[model samples]
Structure formats: C-alpha cells, structure tokens
Target: MLNRISLRQMEYFVATAKHGSIATASAQIHISSPSISAAIAHIEAELSVQLFVRHPSKGLGLTAIGTLVLQQCEDVLSQSSRLYEIAAESSAAIQGSLRVGSFQSLTAMIAPEVIFGFSRAFDRVELQMVEGDQEVLMNKLRALEIDLAITYDLHQGDDIEFECLATLPPYVLVGEVHPMAQLRTITLEELAPQPLVLLDLPMSRDYFTSLFAKAGLTPNIVARSSSTEVVRSMVANGIGYALFNIRPKSNLSLDGKRTVRVRLAGENRPMLLGLATYKAMKQSRLTRVFMERCRAYISDQYIPGMSSSAFFDRYVSGS
Candidate 1:
C-alpha cells in the first residue's frame, strides 16, 4: 500500500486540501480535475480510509482521518523538496522549484523578463508565479506559499523583509482629449475637482487616497476597479483620470484608445518596487539566485515592459 502511493498523488492531495476543491487545485497546479480526482481516489483506496467529504455546494471537507493524513503528506512533500535543495547545494548548477508572487499590477510587466527569464537561464529550475495585491502577497509570504514576492514597500510588518530596487513616483493617467493631458504636471489640488478613476486594490487604494488626505482634500472618485488595465481603459474612454506608478510602454489602452501619463506634482510618497520575503524563513539556493536575477533585471533606469527611463526623465524635467 505504501509503495503504491506516489509523491505526485501526495502533491494533488495537498493542493486539494489547501484549496478545498479538486477543480481549484487542478487550475492552480495546471493538472486536470479528473487526474486529481483519480489520485485522491487511489490514495484513499490504498489507505482504506476516505479522505474528503464532498458537498454539493460547499465543496470538499477533510474527514478526521483525512486531516491527520494531510499533515503527514505535507511533511513528506517538504522532505522531498529538501532533496532537490541538497543536490543544488552540492553542485554548482542552480536547480529547484521556485514559487514567486508578484503584485497584480507589476506581474504583466516584470514576469516576461524578470521571472520567466530566470527559469530560462536556469533550465533545471521549475518556476511558478502567483499574482495578488499587497495584502495577499504578504499573507502568502507568511504562510510559506511563495518563496519571494515583487511588490511595493507598503504595510510590511516586522515579520517581512523588503529589499528596495527602484522608486516609482506617482503619476496621473488621462485620456488624450482631457484638458489636463496637455499639462506638463498635475497637483492634487488641481486633481481634486476632476473625476477620479481609482485603482482600488488593498494597500494601493489607501496609498492613492492618502495622497489626497494629506493635502486636506478628497478626490471626486467617479469609478473604481481592482485591475490596472480596467482603470486604463476607463481613463482612455474619458471616464476619469487615474493615478498610477508603474508606467507601461504603451500609451494606448487595451481598447486601443490613447491615454496620457502626466507627472504628479509636489512632494508625495513614492512606491518602492522591491522584493519581499518572510524574515524567519531560511534562504534556499534557488531563492537566493532568483533574488539576484531580480536585482539585476529591475532598476530605476530600466524596468522590463515599462516606459523607458528617458520618458520619466523628460517628464520630470518638463522637457
């Protein structure tokens, strides 16, 4: 029975237990639902104990025996992961699985060059990326769900360590036809009266609103969305100007409408783009190499898929 149970079966079980559904686990791990279900069934057959109690609407729940078995499975997976780590340490080649998380807004820009490039450079390593807001990424780091996260230096507690890479100052996005789009720079006072399309992600929302709060003004928020692309599209359609930090290379929205980025004036807080990790967790060779790759790839002068530093310099200099 023990010989029949494989590590892949344990991985499927762990993913299902963590997510509470076979379908959700299949999506996350890129496996088919039937495969996961079969693995779960095989594990149960070998052990002769039911692992999950299925519900029609509520999804699956771990039985008493299942809960006990889940803990052992996690331990086995952890031990198996360490084998790769041990092999990597003995050899000069970097080879292991790395789970990286990125802020939702930064994922599309950085993933191509920074994250995916690392995997290509180190062919032996298996890299997976998860995207979320600041709050979600922080929680994942704490839970050991992701090895590292590329995010802003916001709300980072004592338990997390942040290494700053670049400073992305706030900017405004406006439709090409908007009056303010012609301006060299914009201030919070000038912006307070206009309709605002807010990128309303967790800590991000607070950061943008705080800029108004500190100036003793409230923005006239007309629309809101958690997605950056959605906010860009709304701005391009003349919904309202939105505030942002990571400037993409393209001025056109996904809908093919042109949008303009105007520099935000005055001394406002800038988001520090950087890597985040759990302070208590020991650095594995794979993680350390990946961090090095990130540092080399991202900087103030250049960020992959974002507007060039020349654009930033010209805007700030009012050229």
Candidate 2:
C-alpha cells in the first residue's frame, strides 16, 4: 500500500522548498522551526525518500526527486487554497437566516436598505430584524440573542466593538412659522430659554444633557416623549423645538408645508450611525462576508464626494 501523506506535511514541505530554509518557512507560516523540521522528517520517513540535501554551512538543497515533489506540492497547495475560497464564496452566497437588532429610528431609515442589499446579494439569506431602543438592543447583543446590531456609539465596554459608518450633525426641528425658523443657526445659549420637548429616551436624553452641560446652559423642558414622530408632530404644531441628530425625511412639513430644520450654532456634535458586534464572538464565514458586504454598501451609498466605482475597484482589486 502507498504511504499516506498529510496536508500539514505537504504544507511544511512546500514552505521549506520555497524559502530554502526551515527557519524562514517557520517564520513565514508562524510556526516554530523545530516543528517544521520534525514535520519534514516525519514525511521523509514515511515516504522513505531523501528529499533534501542538507549541507553543513549551506542551507537545504532539493534533490532531483525532491524538486519534482516540490512542484507537485505547489499544485496541491494551490488547489487546496482554491477549494477553501470556493467553499467560503458558496457559504456567503447561500440563502440563510440572520437575526439583527437595531434601534427604532434606524428601522425606518437605514435598516431597510441594508436588509434589501443583503437579500439582493445573497438571495438565500433570510433577514429577521428586531427593533428596539439602544438599551434593549445592547442587552440583546450582550446576550447573543442577535447576530448583529446597528445603533449609536454607546461606548460600550471592551467586549463590544463599535464601527462608525456615518455621522450627522445635531439639528433642531420646529414649526415653519416659529420665530427661530427664520435663522440658519441658533446658539445653544440662545435656545436655552425656550421650552424644549425632550426625546425622553436614555441615550438621546443623556447625549443632549451632556451637550447642554458642555455649553454651560440648560433647556426648559415642557414635554417629553420616546416617539420621534410624536416629537416632530408636537414641534410642527409649535409646541417646542426638539433637538435631533438627523433631518427627518417626512414631517418636514406637517400640513403640506416644509417644516424648519436649523443647524445648531455651536460645535455640532455628530450622532454616529454604526455597527456593533461582540469582540469575543467567533464570526462564521457567512457573518464575515455579510459584514464585508454591509461595509461596502455603506461606503458606496453614504460616503460623499468619493467615487464609489473607483473605490470599489481599488478595494476588490486589492491595490
């Protein structure tokens, strides 16, 4: 019976052959030199072939048979790499299920497009979206109940990693006829005296409170609500101006007229739309591919003044 050869032996053999030294090959492959030497020795013993001519001063030299074996080893290794890549591509392309958690505001805005893009690219992927506030979403992420999360930069601990995708400056929304609507921007101090309708959510409230503290001012709260739409409706009806991160697509006008969106005068703190994933969680092949697609899609669509075509070409080409 022919002697059986393991993939590891072939890999070590090929690396040693290509580099001309076991030390260099070990460094390249992140393995110890002793291990590489032992693997080659074991393979030689099994095959009963003197593959390498090791000299006292000169490094390893391949014998005639070793040279032929090395050529075949290269072919085998190349095929193995291709097989892995094909399997990964198939896994990425397969339709499966992904459970995602996202904030309420994102569900109506970015989440839909992200889901659509993922579905279009990987038609076999069935998307399940769970909508909640930041706290709820973060809790689910910590518990591993969701595969991925889209939310604000909560500055969660080291266990969770946040990647900011887009940044939108803080703005104030008010009725078109409101006095402040005529101005392009109003200072935090200037708006300090007006009645404010707070979002009442923990994240939003904390962010605004910190902003107010930084500005050395305080807002007089007349009403509070968790619903962004409700806040917009109240602002449109002249209840009060509400500070928000992004300009709303709808409710720009309450009753057929455009409402007002004014950029705050002071340093505009950006609200970041980002992705969050657990640092410790082992990412599956499908998950990694989907994440890559998400990043590519976001960069293509959201990045301004950059040529998406050129960027994609450079990225895919690995240049």
Which runs of model 1 end up more than 4 angstroms from their true locations?
1-93, 315-318
Task: Give the per-residue lDDT digits (tens) of candidate 2, residues 1-319.
Answer: 5434555567878999888899999899875565567567756777788899988887899999898888987887788667545654785545577877877866666665665656665656777788888888888888888877877886567788888765666777778789988777778888888989888886778887677888777888899999877778788888899888754445454356446777676675777777888877776666666665555434312322222222222322335
Number of colliding residue pairs in model 1: 0
Q: For residue 295, what is the lDDT in candidate 1? A: 68
Which has the greatest TM-score? 1
For each of the candidates, give the backbone clash count: 0, 5
Model 1 lDDT tens row, 1-319: 1524666678889999999998899899876665567668768988999999988888999999999999999998898677546655655548778999999999999998889987876678888999999999999999999998999999989999999887898989899999998998888999999999999999999999999999999999999999999999999999999999997878899999999888888999999999999999988977987786676567654566775445565754568
What is the Å distance of residue 157 in model 1 from its true position?
A: 0.5
